[model samples]
Target: MPKDTDFLYVSARIKYLETKLLGKNDIERILDAPGPDEALKLLNDTEYGYDIAEMENIYEFEQVLDKSMLRTIRTLKESFENHELITFFTLKNDFHNLKVIIKSMILGKDNGYLSRLAEISPEEIKKYAEGERAANIPDSLKAAYHKAMGAYELTKDPQRIDFALDQALFDEMGKIASTSRDPFLREYLTALSDLTNIKTMLRLKKIDGDIRTLDNALVNGGSLPKEFFKEMFLESSQSLIEALESTPYHQIIDEGITQWESTGSPSVFEKLIDNFMISLARRGLYKPFGSETVIGYLAARENEIKLLRIIMVGKINGISSDMIRERLRDVYV
Candidate 1:
C-alpha cells in the first residue's frame, strides 16, 4: 500500500486545478450567450481555452471537449503510479467507444467520431468487433464484445448490445475497486449499481417489458441483490421507494421517481445521479492527500464538461437559459 505523503505534490496540483473549475456564474454567462459562436467565444477564456482555440470550426465543438478529456487522461497517466487503479474512473469511455463501434457495424453509420480517451484504442475495438484478435484488449472488453455480438446474432436485437456492454462496465468498475482495495470506489460502485438497477426496474415497469428484460438490464455488483429487484417488481412505486427507506439512496430514488412521474423522462434522475456522484467525490477534497484528491478533481472536471456540453448544445439550438438550466448538472465549485 502507498502512503498518503506519496501523493502530496500531485494532490496539491489537483487541488489547485479544482479551484479553477467553473462556478454557477461562469456557467450562467455561457448559458446567456447569444448563440453558439458567442458560447464558443466564452470558453476561449476558460481552462478549455487552448483546446477551444484549436477548433477550426465553431460547430466542431466536440473536438474541444474530446481534446480536453484526452488531456485530463494524459495528466492522470503521467502523474500517477497506480495507473490501473486510476484508469477505473476512465474505463467507461473505453466501453462507450466499443458501443459506438459495434453500433456503427450494426447500423452502418460513420464510426469516425469515437472518443480517444479509451484504454482499448478504437482500432483495437474495431478489430475485435470484426472478429479478429487485438493486442492489449482487456478481458472485460473481450467478454462484452463477444456477448454483445452473440446476442445481436442470436436475437437480432440491438438493445441487448447496450445492456450487455453496460453490465460489463459496472462489473469491471467493481472489480477494479475490489482489486485496488479502495473503499470509496467500492461504495461509489455499489451506489451506482444499485441506482442503475432501480432505473432499469422502473423503465421495464413503464414499458411493461418482461421480467427477462429486466433481468438482463439489471447490472451485477450492486449492494442490492437481483432477488430484491425480482421482488421489487411486484410492489407499487411508493412501496418500492418505501422499501429503500433504510438505504443511503432513498432520497435520490424518492426525488428521481417523482421526476419520472412528473416528466416521464429519465434525464432528471440521471442529473441527480451525476450530482450524487460528484457529492461522493467531494469527500475526496477534504482528505488532503492520496488518490482521493485525484478522484475528486476528476469527478469535478467531468461534471464541468457535462455542464459545458449541455449549455453549448442549448446555445447552438437557441434554447432559453431557463431550459438550459434545467438540463444542467450541479457544479462542484
Candidate 2:
C-alpha cells in the first residue's frame, strides 16, 4: 500500500473497532452487577470477547482480557506496518512485565504473587531479567530498570521500587513523545508528562519530601513551564493551591488536599491522579495519526485487568461489592 493509503486503511479499521468499545451504560451496568461473575458475563458477551470461549469465573475473565489485548496489538501492528509505532506499544508492555518481575524478585515475592500480571510468558520475563545485561535491554527499559535499582538502593524499601519504576517510565515516555513526528502524539505526550509531574509533586508533598527527591522524580517534557516547578517549591500548600487554580489539575489537587485533611490519608489523591491519567488515555484515543490511540487503548485494557484483579481479591476476602467498587478504577472505555 502507498504510505498515505496505509494510514487511511488503518484509521478506517480503528474507527470500526472504536465503535465496538464499551459504552458508559455498559460500565454502569457492570458497576451495578451483583458479583464479579455477572460482570464477567457482560464483558464476555461483547465484541471484544469474540475469542473468549468462557468467562464464568475471574480467571476466565482475565484470560479473555489477555487474549483481547494481544489480539489488539496484533491487529494494529498488522494494519499499520509502522515499525516505530509497533515498537513503541510493544516496549510499553515490555516495561510493564519487566517491572513486575524485578519488583517481585527484589521483594522476595513469588510467582504466585505475580498471578495477576498479564499472561506474558513468565519464562521470557525471567530470562530477560536474569540473562540480559542492563545495557542490552531497550534504551527506555534499561534506563527504567537502572533507576529502579537505584531507588531500591536509596531506601531498601520495596514500595519505593514501584515509585522509581514509574518515574523512569515517565521519563522514557516523555522522550519518546518529544521525538515522535506526529504532532498529536506529541501533545498526548505533553499531557501525560504534565499529569505525571503533578502526581510526583503531590506524592512528595504528602511525604514532606525535599526538592532534590522531587527533581529526581519529576518527569520533564510538559507544556508546564519551568516557572511552575519553581513556584511549586516556593509556595505553601495554599500558595500552591493558588498556582494550580487555573490548571486542569486544580480539582484533582483540591480534592486530594481535602481527602488528606479529612481522613489523614493521601491515598485518595493518588487514586484520583491515577484515574486522571486513565482518563487522559481514554481521550487520547479520539485523536488520529498519533501514538495516543495505541497507548490509550493499551492503558485502558491494562486498567480493566487491574480492576478485575481488585474485584477478585475482594471476593476472596469476602469484602462487600461496594467496597470493591470503591477500590475499582475508572474504566477508560
Note the clash tally of each candidate: 0, 0
Candidate 2 lDDT score relative to the true structure: 0.65
Provide the lDDT at 286 for model 1.
85
Which TM-score value belongs to model 2?
0.77
Q: Summarize candidate 2's per-residue lDDT along 79-151 as a digit string, tens digits.
A: 7766454454445555567677887777677533333233245455566667555334455565666777778
TM-score of each: 0.95, 0.77
Best by TM-score: 1
Compute the lDDT of residue 331 as modeled in candidate 1: 83
In model 2, the worst 10-residue window by lDDT is 111-120
Which stretches of candidate 2 lie above 4 Å from their native place? 1-6, 48-57, 86-92, 108-125, 131-136, 150-160, 225-235, 265-333
Put down candidate 1 lDDT per residue, 108-195, tens digits, no spaces.
8875467776777788888877878745687778988998888888888888988999998888887788887777767777878888
- The alpha-carbon RMSD values of the candidates against the true structure, listed in the order shown, are 1.7, 4.2
- Looking at model 2, the pairs that clash are none
